[model samples]
Target: MAGIGFELRKMMRRDTLTGVAKAYLYAGVISSGPLILSIIGMLLIGVLSLGKVIPDFLITQFQVSVTYLIAASLILTGFVQLAFTRFMSDRLFEKRIDLVLPNFNAVVLIATSMSGVIGLVLAFTLFADLSLGYRVLMITGFVILSNIWIAAIVLSSVKEYKHILGTFFIGYTVTVGAALELNRFGLEGLLLGFVIGHFVLLIGLSGLIYRNYPSDRFVSFEVFDKRFAYPSLIFVGFFYNLGVWLDKFMFWFGPGTGQQIIGPLRASAIYDIPVFISYLCVMPGMAAFLVRIEADFVEFYDEFYDAVRSGATLAHIQESRDMMVRTVRAGLYEIMKIQAVVILLIFAFGDWLLDKLGISTLYSPLLRIDVIAASLQVLFLGALNVFFYLDQRKTVFSLSFVFVLLNGVLTALTLHFGPGTYGYGFAGALLLTVIASVYLLDRKFEGLEYETYMLQKS
Candidate 1:
């Protein structure tokens, strides 16, 4: 056991950005296990419910309802992801590891407590809005569990160990069980299973976090600056999420032109659902991109640290601009690889698969649009991440605004034009925005030497 621990630490060693990058990848996988499984499970259910086990009405109901539910959840939790990430980043930058957890503890407790109260109240009141009030209740449950899972990620990002694997499995298994149980109850049941699973896993993860990371090193301080963290995070997070949902909102509102385009409201047919489902593949690429960016920055930070330590001149250190280029390349490579595989799979078996799943007719075009958009977005996301490491936050903000504004305008135009055009317009706009953003961020970071000096000086 002693030897094993030593080996584990060695394996997780990092003298460069890559180490942090690897850790971040592992962190993503561990935390996202449940979500990954749930997504696949939902996909499987999509296949089953599509062609016929469920009637067309049920399938249509499922798609629209799930869309709203997902949108609502994203809006609610979007800020959590940003705030927590910023909190972690600040602590990491300051080299204050312990304070991170205490702050997280404060955040997590407040969120879960609010979720419980709000969920309970909604479970009782919104009973009218949902034919299945139990699903709402289940969502409330997810809120609590999601908070725990987020808390766990905040901890793992700073300090990782093999114990994360065990904890992840525990939560994942619970989720599986919950899914099975909820399957029996239909819509409400599935949601219930999801909620219960998250709840159980949350407890398990919390325990794992406590057992592995104690409060011993926690700082006892009187310093408090809310602006340092929350404002930037909220800004970054809001714009990012806005970029993500912009297309969806457009699709919901825009029909555009085309026999293929299926507006969200008109997407009642099972066949039309595939277009949207194909986009989920982009997630893996997004993950890979983030991991690469993390590693590259870690290397940069280390180099900067070493250069400053030895009193190396700023010009001497400035020669190492290869890090950003490498990061961009790494991200591009991984996204291309993942994208190629998923896209090919979808192409070869898309129609038959959709048929077998009983997808409604209205969704056929949506599947194509979703898949293409997601692939394009993966590269865009990678580029944005690079810009983030470059510390061009203002540039990122500008680019983000463009994405949001353009997507919104496109959506409105599509709606004016009528039904199918929104999807294509939105996807194309997103891809274009990515190219534009990357170009601008690169320009902003053109004077890397000065930035490096400033960054190192601080």
Candidate 2:
């Protein structure tokens, strides 16, 4: 994202409305494009296969299978995602560019191997009742998707947004197209198409990484060394991703809330659709996040640290810290403002939107609340980004842990309270986390100079 920030800053330097639009547009696409494509592609496959595939339950099964794959892979790989990103950032900072590609290969290999074993065990054991073809495709898709996530962390460092966007477009397009053609064979066919598309996506992203970052060695296990690893970041990544999904998992598996769709998979019809639609609304806020935080906030963040490292005058360093604080506040405010407008629009027409999509308008209330929760999630992410820039791993880990705890307890209470209270738990958890994060950020900035000087290894 910092890499994309440089490109975005270059575009904004043009100092024209068109230039500003282009920068944000690119940021939005690059930040949220793959997710939007995956959501739309899945929905498109479901819709297109409606009549072609027999027995509507098969469609639901396919959707559930893909959903489980995505959720499980993300949570499983969460241990490495942020930790590996931090590793690469440190290496780049130390000008050990060659180490990045090789170490990335090591992480990918490690992640995929572990995911493959877990996926295979689940596919064969848990899905024993399903066709062997379906089980094989499911595990294959899971492995490929896991690898894709690992590749994407490295790809984010590449400046060529257009290529990244193009690769995702082609991959998902092939997914939809191939799924449509393969649906005559039913659920197994659909899973196969998904596996094929994501396999293509993995290769394309890997190619981009290899081209952009050529390493003399093919792979290395140096990232596993104690000096390079941050256990706090590992927990932060895991707990954060786990927190994000915990509420949904509660809904999916809670008593009377969800029905088993497949072997071990359950889904809440009352909860899942609104949550899915609400996530789509995050694109606007995501654009604002990348542009404001990455481009605007990071500029001052770098300046503040640079001033400290260069032993600038106290007054100058204080000025830089003030600017950084101001940017952080403004950036968060801009994200909230942008997301507010989006939420308002959704509130105004949510019933109609649900009606158009053939979902019951009864979903409108849940959708509205889910939108708010999603917006708060964007704010939460913004705050975490700021904390990361300030090197506050302990703060991140604590916030993430609190979110998981709150969401689990509150969401369970909501389940006990009934339908009317649903969605409030996730929203409440984020609201509290964001408030706490903002307070801690302010405190950190207040003592920025003291910490910089006193916290050193010397």
| Best prediction by TM-score | 2
lDDT of each: 0.57, 0.89
- Residue lDDT tens for model 2, 1-458: 48888888899889999999999888887778555667778899999899899987899999988988888888888999998999898888887889988998999899889998998888778788878898888888888888888888887778888898889988998899888899989998888888888888888999899998888999999999998889998889889889999998999998879999988899999999999999999988899999889988889888988998898999999999898899889989999999999999999999999999999999999999999999999999999999998899999999999999999999999999999999999999999999999999999999889989998787
Model 1: residues with Cα > 4 Å off, grouped in runs: 1-36, 44-69, 113-139, 145-149, 152-166, 216-224, 249-272, 308-310, 314-316, 360-365, 418-422, 454-458
Q: Cα lDDT for residue 352, model 2?
A: 91
Root-mean-square deviation (CA) per prediction: 6.1, 1.1
How far residue 149's Cα lies from its native spot in candidate 2, in Å, is 1.1
Measured with C-alpha atoms, the lDDT of residue 232 in candidate 1 is 54
CA lDDT, candidate 2, residue 221: 91
Q: With candidate 1 superimposed using the best TM-score fit, by how many Å does residue 302's alpha carbon deviate from the native?
A: 2.9
For candidate 2, list the clashing residue pairs, or say none: none
lDDT of 1 by residue, 42-103 (tens): 55544444444234444334434444444444555555666666556666668665666566
- After TM-score superposition, the amount by which residue 130's alpha carbon in candidate 1 deviates from its true location, in angstroms, is 4.3
